[model samples]
Target: EWAKAFNPFFAGENADWLAMIPFGILALILYYVGRELLLSGKKTRA
Candidate 1:
């Protein structure tokens, strides 16, 4: 009963795409940060 109430994708309800926007942005930021760190490391080593 409590689980059903907290579940966002409950039956008959459409999934909320808006809720995922922040997560997508966070993923992009992490990707860029990781890329920069790797590049910096390689440059420093070489």
Candidate 2:
């Protein structure tokens, strides 16, 4: 019971989860663009 009262940072749990959302989205988008460029660089119909 006292431990809960002692910690104040736990209030940001949802905020912490929200913070990572943009980074995750950017990383996924980066991977997609990189993959597209890498495959497009190859020229061959075999």
Candidate 3:
């Protein structure tokens, strides 16, 4: 990921918050995708 090299450029001094964006976005996408799959199953009415 270009984020690696770009990080030092933008991160500057405070690296903690700068590094969290990628990880936070990943977790959010995974959670939403999993939720969609879980709710995808439907029951048929007799």
Candidate 4:
């Protein structure tokens, strides 16, 4: 009941792509930040 209200994927027949949008955005942000940190560390070591 309440869980369904929080998560559309559980209550709906169709896949909830919208619910995953935030995850995708967060993944992209983490990827870029990690990449930048790695590059900076390499530059500092050299």
By lDDT, the candidates rank as 3, 4, 2, 1
- lDDT by residue for model 4 (5-31), tens: 776766765547767888999898889
Candidates in order, TM-scores: namely: 0.47, 0.49, 0.49, 0.48
Q: After superposition, how far is residue 31 of candidate 3 from its true place, in Å?
A: 0.4
lDDT of 3: 0.73
Which parts of model 2 have CA positions greater than 4 angstroms off? 1-11, 37-46
- TM-score of model number 4: 0.48
Candidate 1, lDDT over the whole model? 0.66
Task: Itemize residue pairs with steric clashes in candidate 4.
Answer: none
Clashing pairs in 2: none
The residue-by-residue lDDT of candidate 1 on 1-46, one tens digit each, is 7645776654325446646777999888889888795345545544
Query: What RMSD value applies to candidate 2?
Result: 6.4
What TM-score number comes out for model 3? 0.49
TM-score, prediction 2: 0.49
lDDT of 2 by residue, 1-46 (tens): 6534564434444666766788999888889778785345767788
* lDDT, candidates in the order shown: 0.66, 0.67, 0.73, 0.72
lDDT of 3 by residue, 1-46 (tens): 6755676736567687767889999888888779875455786799
